[model samples]
Target: MPLDRRQFFQASAALGASFALPAPLLAAEKGKERRIDLVSSAFTVALDPSGASRSAVWGFNEQLPGPTLRFRRGERVHLAVKNELPQETAVHWHGLRVPNAMDGVPGVTQHPIATGGRFDYRFELRDSGTFWYHPHQASFEQVPRGLYGALIVEEEKPPSVDRDEVWVLSDMKLDNQRQPVEDFGRILDIANDGRIGNQILVNGLVAGSQRTLTIRSGERLRLRLINAASARFFRLAIDGHEARIIAFDGQGVTPHPLPAGGLALGPGMRVDLIIDCMGSPGQSFPLRDLGRPPATPTVLGALTYSSQPALRSKPLASAVTLAPNRIAEPDLAKASDHYIIFQGGMRGSPVIGLVDGKPSRIQEIMAKQGLAWTMNYNAQHEHALMHEPLLHLRTGEHVMLHMINETDFLHPMHLHGHFFRVLAVDGKPTPHREWRDTVIMGPRQSIDVAFVADNPGEWMYHCHILDHAAGGMMGTIVVE
Candidate 1:
């Protein structure tokens, strides 16, 4: 339900009221479990709205992007995932604080849901923010084949807006017949910038100016943008509207206008934006992907105003700040400092990288082992039996991890089970110091992030570029 002015204020006030319900009664009501059956099977989808051709896809619940799972904060969710496809798969809740066993990396945390098998994932919603879920098993192939969806945890006191929307931004590589190309896990793609899809998609359909978001003038919208692409990055900008970012990767942050270069959403990242429809009636504003060539920016969609009169004479004056999640801040003075150097890609020095148990150079491994990238001078395959974790810390240790990217390719590194405060970018202090679960690291750049490792378990830390993880940019952090 949309939070109107009255409900918004009441909810905000309820945050301070402790005299409402008894602890046992409140726990019983809030802990009421909701279960849903999620099935992954092979289906055909016409990604092009014209229905030129249908692409064979493997998605959850017969949908390209799967069903959007909604839950209130503190609610218990039981996801009974049934695997109907021929291959094994497992769903990973991208940004939620699930138990170590429920983290969903096949073979690492729990066994993959085998073909024709079912896995029950039960967890409580500990955070209120926009999140998503996708297959962690062979993600390079599964994700592009259309197996991802939004997971929204409604805030106790959300912003008052005309409407709240979620846009799952993704891409797909297709042939002339609109069939998905089976050339996944290629060495060339893994070695360089991960494989990029030709067709950009917004919620399953092809994204273009035809994909429109209708609104009335002088209305405010809470737009949650999620990037579920394998490797694509969206540097987005609206033609005539001002978009202020309210949160990053679901965590609340100080509301602010878009940075000078617009919003850069890397793969597996999410951003919440507050867009005020100040346009005139019948006007349309194109949402362009500026990351492409400046000569011709790709219009992902358009924001068009209805023919009706303005909703109000002026924009909504309600505060856009979101309720922050429960995350422990890192004390820099006592936090242990660690460094991870990212190496190997298409172009780099003739460095030796560990492949399996043997050391191999970049050139030889791609042809023989289908590996391309390395972390800390070692390359690891997903769910590999011999792989070792990158970092190990006590259950509540404060860690200041400095990630040094040496390659010439971009990597959106994602850390599971925890949101870290981005302390610095390229050795310089960040202004907002926002918290994010997934962060983009530029070529030859260094990023310093600090967080308290309070979530005890073995967590995967890998590049969000699915191919890169299959290549070698995959590792785990152990908090015991």
Candidate 2:
């Protein structure tokens, strides 16, 4: 029998509720800054309703998403990472601007911590926004296996909200047994869309048992959505509500209504939404993923109103204002213009390029690393996290990059430690003029982005596609 819409939704809810919901990991409490220990080790997590089916993976503190490390802007964080896994690993603070020596890129900033060894990461939190931490060494394998967590830096006086929530979105490839598929890098996958997973998880919860956010009618919420996926780009919408975008990629922006179509969140990107629950009491609305196919919109979670009387019938305010960060506006007049071409992938015309300063062919890259991607005709084959700076600049210099995408795929290019003002897309200027740490580039398209070289350090810039980055689509920037 064909399933109707109601039946389909009921089935989905049943599937989600069949498994035991894991206890939510609490964010570190606000207090004096002190040393925190995180252990990287192998663990088992249930990805299916059966509960018997578990995937063996590596994680921090043996938790699926580790812990949510919370801090106030300007507070010092001292973390000691203990590696219990067999191989070496290092944590990269995804969007924080820290001293180069503590940046956590193995071999770039520091050597990887060997098995049973510990490394201390001491840095001051400078930015207040949604950021993340994950293994920079062998990230293609480490991140996908589940060694990642949310790092939230709160502003001194945070916006008034009934509740604050962090949603970290991720996916995992699974086998018939509901175990994580062990294939890390297939040439075709690396050359194309990276590793598209078969199962999606929201804050470590699988399909059936994803928690619902319950709120009193007319309550305001601050939802921090982090796209922790290796490659998936989320086109998200909340049914029966409007989400005012308050921030993007850890930087506050002028509040604006989320696009009617949806908010597109690329990998490694974070979006802060101020949502007012206007629905009637006892009603439940879905947070839908419109990016997936039309077969069924992926219901990430539900926003259910409390059974109590409604507080208000309308939204709190039509416009919400947020204090911007200290990021300097890009000086477009004095910006030095540079163009970087992205080429190579599966199904595209073959092109020869340099891999680690040596001339190489597409086939050679595949043979060497099962890679199928390149950035600016350079296939990054270096095992270490460090690479020679692709662009070097003096501190505080304004730089504009024209990233031309020649590949026949979408690449969410991400720059570490700093955010850039999006100048234009495909030659047209952006109306919002928002700042972002990651920007999506479509096939055969070009994007002009400008940023001040204010953070003096060696930072990695690469495709957010983990497989593609591992395959060679990565570079570094040096600001001195």
List clash counts for every candidate, in order: 0, 3
Candidate 1's displacement at residue 212, Å, is 0.6
lDDT of 1 by residue, 1-480 (tens): 123435533443343122111111011232477776677889876676566677899887666677677778888978879999889999999999899889889878899999999999989999999999999999999998888988888898888999787888999888888888889988878887788888998878788888888889999988889999999999989888789999999999999988777688999999999999999999999988888456357898889999999999888888999888889999999999999999888896777887676888888777777778889988877878357789999998999999999898889999999999998998899988999999999989999999999999989999999999999899999999
Candidate 2's TM-score: 0.90
Cα lDDT of all candidates, in order? 0.85, 0.80
Error of 2 at 422 (Å): 1.1
Per-residue lDDT, model 2, residue 359, is 77
Error of 2 at 297 (Å): 2.0
Cα deviation in Å at residue 182, candidate 1?
1.3
Model 2 agreement with the true structure over 403-433: per-residue lDDT tens digits: 9998888899988878899889999998778
Best by TM-score: 1
97 Cα displacement, candidate 2 (Å):
1.0
RMSD of each: 8.0, 7.3
